[model samples]
Target: MARITAGVGSSHVPLLGVAADTGKDADSYFGPIFEGYEWTRAWEREEKPDVVILVYNDHASAFDMKIIPTFAIGCGERYMPADEGWGPRAVPPVLGHPDLAWHIAQSLILDEFDMTIINEMEVDHGLTVPLTMMFGKPEAWPAKVIPLAVNVVTYPPPSGNRCWALGEAIARAVASFPEDLNVQIWGTGGMSHQLQSPRAGLINREWDNRFIDSLIGEGQEARQISHIEYLRETGTEGIEMVMWLVMRGALGARTRALHRHYHVPCSNTAIGHLVLLPDNGEQPGTDDDRALATT
Candidate 1:
């Protein structure tokens, strides 16, 4: 049966995608930010999973105020990069795992979670940026991706608890798959940083680190964090951090933190990344395991 071997959480700042696409990632300002993912790139090369369930928000590219689905799963065959105003980034189109995606959608619906099934939709930076962070500028993404777009852009987004429960349901769905495939669930967006007025350009390093610590440890604290707390402490957009809990919950009750990286002021956002392996009694590697494991 298909199984989730690892979980990854990352912040999908749009500027990061521009920097990479324009070859500015090697420049001084963005170089350090891109460097943080070097370890992850190498690690992923060795632990290549066949399928990745990417959780991200649409950023008004695919969905807007007209129609917004709180939870949508893509069961399409391919997804082109969306043109967010300027133009679509020069990136490879995303190939979807329709079989797995449809299966997951069915399982979640049967499990009492209402999910919108999308047959075709253009993907924005919210989905592509994390792929760039992990796989770099490849002609084609190494893994087949299943886009799971969550509605965190609009008001009254799903609660952290709700997202966490969705993750558990996803794990159950993946386990029931008959295919013997390696699967990875990824949650993207936010550490903290708001774009709106009054408290715009906010980056709470203290709270961000504390949240990362909670996730790396028992994860109970992160799981219990409320929506109001995120807005009050981390900024309005900081609510995006709740998505990370989905990745954490899918890793089961316990997980071994393989690697973690956190950086601040990246395009006015706190860029955070984590690589976690399910705790099944085996020890993790020591060499380069904590290379970029800064909090």
Candidate 2:
């Protein structure tokens, strides 16, 4: 039984990475935006959890736009970082907790949750950007990460409600595991800024705030929202918020948000950062291991 310490989520905009590394977005672009991640360095040093369950949507990478699952989990020992033009950022590959990952996979299937399990997959900025931002770009990553990828690209994506349900199922799966460990679940991407089409660079702060409010406040209902409504109202790209519901559902119903930051104008994306610490209701797990993986 791993105690979930924190939940992290951020947008995977390639432009931000390029700017951060090239030293181009010092003031306007990267500076203010990355402030949300500064807390990550502190969390790693202070609240270092045993494992992190990352929820991000892959964009045309690994699975491609061909056949995508509503939710996919990586059970491999390591995951490769996708090359996003500027080349891989020289970080340790993410490690996966196969035992827990497999357990969730089995439980989800039995509970009627459709998901994909990947032995090998390359993660793009969708998972890496926010990661490096929060944890800082060292030669390698410090902890193990389990990727629970969701599909927000092609049509027929899962609804927000479905994503939240998946989160609840995952929590149950983890709780049932015989082992004890401290885990963190993260959901990344989106805050209402479309990145494609002629109307690119659109920003809807109002909608973004509302989504955040509903996500942290509403439980099952927030997760159960329809995908059609998300796409129609929030724009196609905005549908990514469904992933957040997964993280919200996994955490305690009455979590205290430690920090929150939102910014737009990074290559047509609204970057949202949130850190939720689960309350003292849950008991601590008795486990003894740190996780790290390279894929």
Candidate 3:
């Protein structure tokens, strides 16, 4: 049976991609940002999953005012990188797991979380930047992916509780799949920075760290946070943090945080990345964990 091996939460800012692509990651301005992911990169070698369920928001790349599905799942065999304003990032096309995506879509609908199923769509930086951050610019991604796009760009996005519950439903769907697959749910975007209006430069590290603390905690307190609170305190654009709750909820009630990194001033955002391993007697995804194993 398929089980959720881990959850990854990260901030997905477009400029970060540009910085990495331009080979300026070690520059003073970007060094802190790139350094934050070093732990994750080290941890990934030992904890790689068969597939990643990437959760991100569409930045007006695929869906315009014409349509906005509160939650959408990509069930296609492949997805091309989208050109958001400037141009598409120089990255490999994303390979999809259509079989698993279809199964999750069907399961979600039956579980009462109606999702907009997409067989075709261009993926924007919101999705690609996180990939670039975690996996780097590989000739091909090390693992297949299932894109789960959430509507955080527009008002009336899924509530925190709703996103959390949907994640729980996805966990159930993954477990019920007959195939033996290692699955990882990755929630991307937000660490308290806004990129629109006069409030574009806002960065609330205290609040962001508190949210991160709650996420690492073995409790649902973070899921109980309201959208209004996220908007009012974390900045309007900072409200994207709701997507992280999805990753948190999918990992069950207990988790062992394997690695965490947080840094400021990634263009107009505060970058955050976290790696978590489920604590149900499952082995940690690292050689160090194996060496120190108590059980």
- Specify the highest-TM-score model's number: 1
Name the runs in model 3 displaced over 4 angstroms: 281-295
TM-score of each: 0.96, 0.88, 0.94
* Model 1 alpha-carbon miss at residue 9, Å: 0.8
Clashes of each: 0, 16, 0
Q: Give the TM-score of candidate 3.
A: 0.94
lDDT (0 to 1) per candidate? 0.89, 0.74, 0.86
RMSD of each: 1.9, 5.5, 3.0
lDDT of 3: 0.86
Error of 2 at 180 (Å): 2.5
* Tens digit of per-residue lDDT, candidate 1, span 1-295: 9999889999999999999989899999998888889988998898888999999999998898999999999999999999999899999999999999999999999999999999989999999999999999889999999999898888889988899899999999999999999999999999898999989999998998888777764556687788899999999999988888888888888777777888877978888888887776555568425433554
Full ranking by lDDT: 1, 3, 2
Instruction: Report the number of backbone clashes for model 3.
Output: 0
Q: Under the 3 Å rule for N, CA and C atoms, how many clashes does model 2 have?
A: 16
Candidate 2 matches the true fold with a TM-score of 0.88
Flag clash pairs in model 3: none
